[model samples]
Target chain A: MSQELYTNIAIFVLSILVGFEVISKIPSTLHTPMMSGANAIHGVVVVGTILIALEAHSVLFYVIAFIAVFLASINVSGGYVVTDRMLQMFSKPKKTDDQKQDGGDK
Target chain B: MYLVSAACYVIGLHMMRTPKTARNGNRVSAVGMIIAVIMTFLIVINKHEATMTGSIVLAAGLILGLAYGTIRARTVEMTDMPQLVSLFNAVGGGAAAAIGTFDYLSLTAGSHISFAFSFPVALDLVIGGVTFSGSLIATGKLAGNISGKPISFPGAKLLNAIVVIVIVAAVVLTIGFPVNAWWLVLTLVASLIFGILMTIPIGGADMPVVVSLLNAFTGLAVAMAGFVIDNQALIIAGALVGAAGTILTLQMAAAMNRSVMNIIAGGFGTGDSNSAAAD
Candidate 1:
């Protein structure tokens, strides 16, 4: 293996260890939402989709690349939105009056 | 830029350790994604290989998918979150597999073909295909579209055996011989079948753990794709997800008084009427 491949492998292995340690003491109520949030993070596949589009020459290539982009974008956007919704339910805004301002900021 | 985004993801996940800060965790992760997406798009646009038609197709897909994803996310009922999560896995896996397939084809057209490239390509096809089909079936079961009971037919075991044997053969062929598109395609088809077979016999009660397992499969597939392309960000993000999913699977299984081994081995569930009740 080349140096680059070796580095990538090390990165992958170390990241897995980090992932295992990323969340701790999370309540049962947060499991589903936390899972959803993690799901959204993998939407980084969207980056790959765009990278492939750079070399799409044939119609078949373009079509496949398009599907890749489409599906990945869905994963990215939907995952985040769905996660945010769930997390919001567990969120308690103490002062209801400033809710509008908070919403505006968001 | 990619490293920064990756840091954001780790920070986001760290914040998820507590309920009070979990919402912000989601935002931080989303922000990471936005940075990565914009940076990738800019790279694509600046490249001389980029074409107007390609840009149009990419943008169209991005916009359309974004609109639908947001609408579905905003409108779907909370009770349906499991299925929705499965759907996300489906898309993520499918996308990763598609990208790997494209890269494999592109690489074969050239002279330099190495084991490192081909192995990950084949692996991605298998893992991504399984995650794609498995998650879809899980989604169906969760949505009540498919029977949540263990579905064992006369040849179910035989088919499962056949699929596994074929996949193993394809993996060997994929690694030893010169690059063949059929090997990749066969690997994908067999893995997809295996995924379906594995999920169908699992009852409703074990769907959460199964979903988490398939979620991990999707992550590994993406990581394999990263290997094919030599992309660090994908490796980090995908591996992080793979580890987290595995932990979540085991955690949920333990919480439900089930073992990951038995849950993976299937037949633990007798079609529990309250499947998501454990959640």
Candidate 2:
């Protein structure tokens, strides 16, 4: 088999194993955060598109690569940012009944 | 070499799945990644005809990437962990897209478009583009960079539908008439704009669904890229990503006591859902 073919197969296997490994370590409490982070990796699509666009000898391929990278980057970045903020919401302070009672007494 | 990559992925997945064992998982994953990197270099050096300069540059890239990964791993706060994850995923998607692009460009270098590869390239392009935009929007909403208030203009869904139609038409034209490369660029720009529009309407709480969906798109795009390059690894990796993303979307929907269809159809949780149970 060609070296390229062999390398591709290697990458495919690695991705799967990594996917499982990464997911497995996530805590139940942090599932959303973890998911968000992983999802954000989708942004790599931008780099991919750039590579494709530059390397593609034809205008058509270039255009396609550009779009793919542009769109995927948004998805990856936007998704993670949102998730981070949402998780932050969990750590906020909640009002206690005692505090409310004290204020009422005052 | 393949085994090394697989090991890295496995270790990473393990860390991801078992939060209590995150440290160990991370360590394993890291080591695996290092091995994978080594394998990649070995493969390139073993087969590809390249000058010493090219080899040095490639080595530098790998080292830089490793350094970045290590730094991020050590310094990133647990609260920002999700964001980090997203960043990594984006890099992966980008890498796959880049490789696919290289394959396509090499084939079409002589101005004679190879129909066999063009389709996959297009698939990767469209899907990758959409995924990138969608992820960015999701990140903005999550990070408070943008409002998560399900912004809806009149006939937003209709507009989205129109955009999809146009994109499809453009795709058809691109394939049927390779001579018209402009259509590809036009559609790409249009779709990106449409991605932003589609995402702006999604509220914060529904962000998970959006993230999941975009991830699926990323996977599909990678898989297509794989097809274009006739790379088994890309195809398998892409399919795995797509499947995993879809499953997560469903889980998120269930968490909201909503179905995937409801999430996609739009008009969810106009803010009152905050009082409603996330369950």
Candidate 3:
């Protein structure tokens, strides 16, 4: 009912529209990398959640806070790992079969 | 302050929209961030007086985070960007969880209750906890830290169902008897464990979708936290994140030639197109 809730809802709605438009165009090949990049943005969420958790006075909030931290940590570490793996995939040499196929076409 | 955060979110959304002009997008977001940072500082100064522990800690945390984020931003390649994104998301979720816990302890100081703070606080814990664990598992799947293959065990779906049941029970307990804090704690723990198991079976290729979903969770958590604390800025920021994350999830799902329902229903499987498309 507060102004804050209204603003949050508005922003949330707007962002969803924007996110849909933006992510739709990303190439399939780049999906993983893009996702990894986007995950970093979750940092903002983590920070906000942390701030809120810190303010919690209830045991329920405390439990939620702990889980949030744990989940967020997994997110950060996993995203980093995936991005690195994908990059490694790019760096690796193409299979000899693929090279041979190219030569045969020529 | 809310305006500044909104602007940052707007610019960030703009950047996210125009990936081709990503550098420009980054700049726009950066400007927004600067504004947000200043607003945050101003708020701290205004609310807590000249010098307070919260202010000092906030300043220190911001500095450290900024330094770390900057370094990562500069060095991380576009190819590895998704992982970084996931990592950042985790940090956000973790921070949220931490803040909620601290707030609960501080506000209570001793025994008894406050209905005004109860609902929001509980919401923050559940959503934030899920986001934190879910994001991490998605990151692991994406990075190959966990197997890229879709991992499904006997009764995986059933287990998840049971976990959901437990979470619901916990929620009821939390609301029915706010005085009994232990139920709340149990719920969060169960949720965290559930999050890990939920994302673990998903394959690497499907990670983009998973990340998007987790991002949405994180955002919702933040928004809930804002409600708990009656902070406009936090609410706006959280909502922005949740909405964006959900959209991204949909996009990623589409990119995979799948639907969200199919992705989750299919569970984790090694179904590479080149190798098994014809199968």
Candidate 4:
């Protein structure tokens, strides 16, 4: 493997650990919003879509890149918009590490 | 700049640990994405590249996606959020897979790529295609277009196993051989089939976990795409989602009193009448 792969893998492993820690204390009620939020985060694929479109020479490449961008942006925009909508409905603020049992807010 | 955007994703997710802070977290994450996009645009402009047509195509895609995504997110009923999320996962998966396929095609224009490239690209396409089709089916199940009842053909496990083998072969061939376009095709088709087969066997209370797992798959695929393209931003974002999604999947499964392996390995309603492990 190349040194780049080594670096990427290290970054990848560390990020996963960070990810697990960041949301580990969340309640079950927040699952949907959490998933939606995570969905939005992955929409970073849009970066790839943009770079690909700029470099594509063939019509086929352009078309594929265009479709990728369109889908990825939807993922980014819709993901965050909907997540915020869901989180808005909850009037109570979640206290981290205080309440273990779920559906208490309901 | 890429690292900065990735840091935004991390901090944004950290903020999401609470409800009062979640919306701001989302906003922060979006801002990070904005930074990444602007940085990319500046780089492109500085290069003095991109044909006029390419610019127009990019503009149209951005506009159309932003409009549709924003409008739909605004209007969809709260009850349908899961379905909408699944659809988003589908699109995200398809987009990542498209980038992988495009890159694969470009690289194999007459030569072979090393395992470093083929490994990530092949896996990305497989996961991406699986998440793409599987999320759509999940969306259908959630939206009532398809039966929520678990449905599986006789010998479904064997069939899925066969598809798994095909995918493995394709991946191996992609690495062993000179990066033929056909290997990627095989990989995509097989994984798509695998996704459908695995999802159709799952239904009812298990839907949420399935969707969450697929979300994780999409994230993992995006991360693989990042490795393929050697981009730090994609890797960070993808890894974050993948990790978060996995935790969500396990938590949901636990809430339902089932194990993650059991949820997946149990093959709920696999036509075995005596199998009530999930029932």
Candidate with the greatest DockQ versus the true structure? 1
Q: Please list the C-alpha lDDT of all candidates, in the order they appear.
A: 0.85, 0.54, 0.59, 0.87
Cα error, candidate 3, residue B266 (Å)? 1.6
As for candidate 1, its clashing pairs are none
Tens digit of per-residue lDDT, candidate 4, span B78-116: 899899999999999999999899899887454867888
Better of 1 and 3 by lDDT: 1
Q: Against the hidden reference, what TM-scores do the models get?
A: 0.91, 0.66, 0.73, 0.93
* Model 4: pairs clashing at backbone N, Cα or C within 3 Å: none
Model 1: per-residue Cα lDDT over B83-152, one tens digit each: 9999998999999999988987775532447788888888898999999999999999999999977776
Candidate No. with top TM-score: 4
Off by over 4 Å in 3: A1-42, A45-106, B49-56, B76-79, B109-116, B268-279
Note each model's CA RMSD in angstroms.
Answer: 4.9, 9.6, 8.1, 4.1
Candidate 2, residues B169-253: lDDT per residue as tens digits? 8777656554444665665666666667767778757776777777677777776776665644345546555655666666677
Query: Candidate 2 regions off by >4 Å?
Result: A1-27, A33-106, B1-4, B7-15, B51-84, B87-116, B267-279
Model 1 TM-score is 0.91
Task: Enumerate the chain B TM-scores of all models.
Answer: 0.92, 0.77, 0.84, 0.94
DockQ of each: 0.63, 0.11, 0.17, 0.59
Task: Kindly list the per-residue Cα lDDT of model 2 for residues A1-106, writing each as its tens digit.
Answer: 5566566656556665545433432334655644554443333333333334334344554444444444444443343344445444543432355467668999
Instruction: Sort all candidates by lDDT, best to worst.
Output: 4, 1, 3, 2
lDDT of 2 at A83: 43
